[model samples]
Target: MPLLFLLRLQHIPLPVRVALSEEVRLVSVLVATGLIEADFAPVRPTGPDAASRIATVKRITEEGLAEIAKMSDAPKFAKTSMRFARGLRLM
Candidate 1:
């Protein structure tokens, strides 16, 4: 989910950004609780090839977002609490 936030803040490919956004919406509660986890593999060129390594990084990011969605949901209590606070002008 932090990846999603960073993607939204940077100039990245639209499709990748959109995928991240959708994943974030699907797992916002885990994000709010700071429970999302992402594994960033180290980049190593196998045969003087760098482009494929970059693609691997992108794929890893997408997979991480998918895992987050599968593990989280929007927390109902947090939403309701925020609404109640706003009603009292304490937000």
Candidate 2:
């Protein structure tokens, strides 16, 4: 399966983030329902190996959140990206 980059963008700890990403499709779904072992497959190398990956995702998310906060009253640039994605359906 493809790695879901978006799935890792939460403000929690590394292990917990990886634990969530391994199975859930979106963070909202994870938050609304809560994490269960059955909800996510067990992450391998459970000790410290997955830490950096999770940390990087967390840092990126924090940066994104900072940027979004600065634009709280503006339309997000993401709307153009979404529009382009929809346009792709016609090509």
Candidate 3:
């Protein structure tokens, strides 16, 4: 899988600015919702065998891609990619 990149364009409210842990929770929720699939791991390596992680989006289900496309086509989400994605960067 490719690495996800984030760009901070401006300051969003504290409520909207989700922490890494919260973002991971949201990704787990998304996976539970069947919209996408992800692999979870520690933010910082705990051991030599530990893997780096950031709730990587290993793959998007067909439904997930369709939903994303639908979101982009919508008026509200068209220009708000980051918000629409929550904290996960789409590939």
Candidate 4:
């Protein structure tokens, strides 16, 4: 699954986060399922007055990490990453 692959790239870019842009549909699914928690900040992408807001991922829930750990294609260390991921902050 995308989420599992996403987690695998945590250290790839030298920091956190797998992707800079995420589809709204996928984000909704992840949020609704309690896979991750995020905070939305209003952004005026089109104009200064635009009320549009963008959300950034804060962290992945323990349950979410467990879900990743169960993935078949996940890294071999995925199962043992729960503790390390618990306090991790996703940007």
lDDT of 3 by residue, 65-87 (tens): 56665654776655577576787
Clash-forming residue pairs, model 4: none
Per TM-score, the best of the predicted structures is 4
TM-score for predicted model 4 compared with the true structure = 0.49
lDDT tens digits, residues 24-76, model 2?
A: 44433333333222123334566653422221122334444544455553456
Highest lDDT among the candidates is held by which one?
A: 4
List, in order, the clash count of every candidate structure.
0, 0, 0, 0
Better TM-score candidate (1, 4) = 4
Count: clashes, candidate 4 = 0
Candidate 1 structure quality by residue, lDDT tens digits, 32-54: 44443322233454554332212
Model 4's alpha-carbon lDDT is 0.56
RMSD of each: 10.9, 12.5, 15.1, 13.8
| Model 1 TM-score, all chains together | 0.22
What are the lDDT scores of the predictions, listed in order? Answer: 0.41, 0.39, 0.52, 0.56
The worst-scoring run of ten residues by lDDT in candidate 1 lies at 51-60
Of candidates 2 and 1, the better by TM-score: 1
Candidate 4, residues 1-91, lDDT tens digits: the string is: 4574346534344223222334433545676888776565555567554445555566677877777667644555675587689879999
